[model samples]
Target chain A: MNKSERLFQLVLLLRSRRTAITAEAIAEAMGVSVRTVYRDVQALVLSGVPVEGEPGVGYMIRPANHLPPLVFTPDELQALLVGNRMVQAFTDQDLAKGARSAELKIRSILTEHLKQHAEQQPYRIPILESDDGLREVHGKLRRACEQRHKVRAIYLDEKQEKSERTIWPLGMIGWTGKWTLLAWCELRHAYRNFRFDRFEALDLLEENFRTTSDISIAHYLQSVIGMRDPG
Target chain B: MNKSERLFQLVLLLRSRRTAITAEAIAEAMGVSVRTVYRDVQALVLSGVPVEGEPGVGYMIRPANHLPPLVFTPDELQALLVGNRMVQAFTDQDLAKGARSAELKIRSILTEHLKQHAEQQPYRIPILESDDGLREVHGKLRRACEQRHKVRAIYLDEKQEKSERTIWPLGMIGWTGKWTLLAWCELRHAYRNFRFDRFEALDLLEENFRTTSDISIAHYLQSVIGMRDPG
Candidate 1:
């Protein structure tokens, strides 16, 4: 094993442990002598690894995360890669682009020789939806929710019937392949769920909402599973 | 650090390296003497750590995922949290519920101190759709795609017109807020993207498909973003 890899493994073991482990036990575990263990421990401490212990007793890692961002283990790299790949495949173009860039940055840090193992992923997240405008709509809804603005939209029903209505926007829900906007309908005098695809056009109103009157996202969560699309 | 942790680090370094590292190099990197490195190498050998070396040469760890599953750095945990939270907050009830449970399980394995930091996440995934049926539809379509079965559905058009059509199911794409089925429509004689909510009823046919001439998911991804619902 290379010195760098051994140091990384040391960080992992120390970080995972809750209590200190004895030098004799550590020596036995590593298949080394007591003197060797003591010297290694001193080396780690001098190099700012925060390894704490005495010569006779034992050693343990500090509770705080003092390591730099680039100090990652092989498994950590795998986890990050799988996650970024999943995001790239499932989300809109903008988010996918972001994930791709992040993957490149992560790859750049893996000490030149260790790069290959980290780059060649053992698993892959399959590509799914690739909508161009989904993230744009997401941004708008997010703004509306944060500003508590009322919104008016021309909506199309399953029968292709058209209806124009003003709604008090609450939250946006993203399904695996679909998106829905939760709101209180001024026309129906009740809570309504609007699908993003059904909206032909939308305009954010200048007015803010009064949360005390209608159902909030939190309240809606506590009530029941009301996911039936009221088309 | 404890001897066990150091030993583990040594193993990690060796496993990731393509070439052997010299004892002097190991000693300098670990901040220890050459004699200490030699003794540690012997200890690791006796304890069945698979540390390979020679009298005047270097050492390396065998290629293996032999490290315990619990070995995780703080950043890896953070990556897992962000991914799972995105799935929980954005997807439907079933996936969200699954994510919530998984977070709890991952937390259970952590040391008590680590548990506190993991539980009160810096960010939150808000509940969106509370539908109990979204998961069921996802399952059926998944089954159809995997089995390569032809599926018939009572589809609702954007114009609200109802039409019964048979389709060769290709793949299901799960967007953050949508669920779409990519298939070849018999009536249209072309590729079509069908939204899950538009399916009034679905029936999987007892027929398997033979791929010949059509734009596949990979091809579509490469050529164009054909996610438009041809309602």
Candidate 2:
């Protein structure tokens, strides 16, 4: 690699570990002579970079130092790209958008070569099949729950009987190829879980509901699934 | 700030922007002498870092460079602590544990001073309530969904009728007060959403399902919600 490239690698090596890095160690890692390592160290220090310690004692990058430019190896880049794609695959609409936005931000930070590779190899993960209608209702319910709005749904039970109820949505849970809504049912006057598919119709009520203060939807779901009382 | 601190700040400034940075620009930004910027650049380059360009030409840290340590400022740490706590509050048991694990990992990477401060501060965000019998089930369901296992749930509809159905769990969506499950029902041979509370019983079958090859759960939900067929 070129001098600049070697210098960049040195900075990365210093940042990766918690302890001080000796110039000899740097030379060994980079397959360069100790003299070259020494020269590079001098260049970094002269450039107003905050590297601590002497040549013999070992070089340390202080924690307070701002991160140098990020450089991802090919594997790392692929991992990120694939992970972002997975997030987009499973998340709600807004969340999917956020994932795309994050990918763009990363792209903006990448070097030309890395950016080119990223464009050439677009990573995408697939999702499972399910009812489109249920997914839509689920999305709406999630938003309503976040907003603490009341939701009205015509729900069907095991007996194939249907009824309407107003609920304060807290979160959602899935099990056994089924989806459930965890909420405080105004009609039931207690916390309840409603099946999403069983709902004949769903309506977002104009009236807003009180949201839970302490726990998040995930935590609440945990408690319900575990059969534990929040109190 | 000390010289080391100053250098750290300079690196952060340059890393924040992916373009070329000049010594004069660094000096003006940090309100330091250009001579000092020159010294810092020399130091960085001498340390075998990959900073491109010379005194007159602008400098840029190459992308091949390694990232500095994962150091978090006090404010940033506080934000993470708070956010993690919030995640812990609402996530299912497994996820809560995962959150704690991540926090511990973060702590391990911090400097002694930051670690001490983190311990002393003991940042905690409270959660309001927990659901009964949901956490464990949620954990199982999440695993099933991840493993692509078939699930069977004893479900109750609006008429207080109960029935059992086999499903392929797709994903979970959380609303304000409740949790919902999305899946493909074997009985209906279509996608369905179910409520966690309505499940009288849930079972995870030994058979594992495969996620669809192209469509993600989010895309399916969007299309379905928009009254479009996923196929």
For each candidate in the order shown, give its overall lDDT on alpha carbons. 0.60, 0.61
Q: Which stretches of candidate 2 lie over 4 Å from their true place?
A: A1-60, A63-231, B1-63, B116-132, B157-161, B213-216, B226-231
The DockQ of predicted model 1 stands at: 0.08
Tens digits of per-residue lDDT, candidate 1, A1-231, equal 444345545556666788888888767866667787777766555333457786565788765443323444544554455455555554344445445434443443356554665533223245544444555665566567657888888888889899999888776655544567888889998788887778888889898876762367645545645443221
Error of 1 at B159 (Å): 3.4
- Give all TM-scores, in the order shown: 0.44, 0.40
Candidate 1, backbone clash total: 31
Can you tell me the DockQ of model 2?
Answer: 0.05
Candidate number of the best lDDT: 2
Q: What is the TM-score of chain A alone in each candidate?
A: 0.53, 0.51
Which lDDT tens digits does candidate 2 get at residues A1-231?
Answer: 756657667777777788988888889999999899888877665443456676457988766444443455643554445434433443344444434433443454566677655544312234434444665776787678656778888888889998788887776553333557777877877777777778888889899866554334544645644544321
